[model samples]
Target: MTRPRRRVKLARIVNERKRKAALKRRKKALIKSLNTICVLCGAEACMVICDRTNNQGTHNKMVWPSKEQAEAMMSRFKSLPQEQREKKAVSNEMFLQSLLAKKSKKLESLRAKNNQMEMEEILHNFAIDPTSIEPATGKLTRLFLYINDLIAKIEENESMSQSATNVNLV
Candidate 1:
């Protein structure tokens, strides 16, 4: 029969050295069980983010590589045989080119959309009468009335100037 597992009383451990040693062992075991290794590049120094599901089955959580680890992995890849290295380089170049092309296409599409909106705005301003487009709200009616009064004042001034000029000519 399997012996009952003993519970560790970490709080009760008074010896500092023993407590530190127990903590180290526990940390190592936890790390080992968690398998903190990068599945992509097989780098041991990595961080686990979260678990993900796939068609095959559930797998261990994804591992994100640190900058130093990623650089080391890249160096290892560079040290590969000549033909393999060349093939990888070509594939990487193609991947980067494809990404750049995709980004450029997206940027062009955004610019086209922005230009279309600007053209529509310009055309709307020139083609459509603002007052005819919709019924005036109370605020807009007040604004229009104010504008009419200004126009009437301008016309009165022009007529007065014309009458003064006629009297001078007579």
Candidate 2:
């Protein structure tokens, strides 16, 4: 049986020789995978790796399917309209903004639901024993306002239902 692979730490390798060797092996594997995917899906694919500055202060690059194919693909991409090119682009800032908005909306929704539940519980308790919450002036005012709001909603719903019934009878 094949042994399971151990999880590798997602950190930069400190040893220069080991790091470069691993990079070479991994780059080859990546290009192989890209070729396999293209062959299986009948799709054009390219991979580029821009290495960090070496001791000589020179950068190196690795490109799959030759430099010519990658350049053609890049040029084709550049020819597209600006809007079309960035239609579904998600940078870190954009992603975080969207996430923040979603979380804020959800938080607001939860707060409203919690307030509704708390008001309902208070109303139930007050109905069971009116003297239990009489000591708090602020709570009493809030409870009164909540009750008024509930009454208004109930009346609105009843009027709409009655109007619908009348319309059906006509």
Candidate 3:
């Protein structure tokens, strides 16, 4: 007899399969609806941002090199037993090297993004003295307004004292 957990798992699997089928059907319909002809090869294709050899009838570009092509290549390499499969091995090695370089570039970009984000946080949060006409926000602006009010009060007292002195002199 199936346990309670097993029943739950089966229900989840059924739901997931339905979801996958719906998604697949949607994709197929969209592809079918693609009305554009491929410019590069003049084939009926579904790609939107079509660029030459990336010309595609579908989202996946590099259709496998074909069994016949592989067999031909194998036969050529077989004829040169001494030459071995050095070319194929070298090509594979280069492919991995390029992949490694791409990964390195992506990592560098992420690190730069993080560094710039931290710098932005510092710029926004830094405290500036509020006496100047420069733009301010949040607590900084409030502090500036408070200081300006104090300065205005002091000026009013100074002007009143000067007028009193003038009146005494007269």
TM-score of each: 0.26, 0.58, 0.28
Cα RMSD, model 1: 23.5
Q: Model 3 misses residue 16 by how many Å?
A: 21
Reference-based lDDT, each prediction: 0.65, 0.90, 0.57
- Where model 1 places Cα greater than 4 Å from the true spot, the runs are 1-80, 90-103, 130-170
For residues 1-170, could you state the per-residue lDDT of candidate 2 as single tens digits? 99998998999999999998989998888888888999999988788899998788988877888899999998998899999989988999999999999999999999989988988888899889988786556778888888899899999999999999999999
Clashes of each: 0, 0, 0
Off by over 4 Å in 3: 1-73, 80-85, 88-98, 127-170
Q: List the residue pairs that clash in candidate 3.
A: none
lDDT of 1 by residue, 8-112 (tens): 664756787776587568656765654544455564454444433546787545343455665676688769888886874557779899999999999999997
Specify the highest-TM-score model's number. Answer: 2
lDDT, candidate 3, 1-170, per-residue tens: 97563322323334766756755675555554543333445643323322124245435332113446546656776788665646546577798999999999999999977855654454455535224334553544554555576689999999999999999999
**Lowest lDDT 10-residue stretch of candidate 1:** 131-140
Best-fitting candidate, scored by lDDT: 2
Each candidate: RMSD to true structure? 23.5, 5.1, 20.8
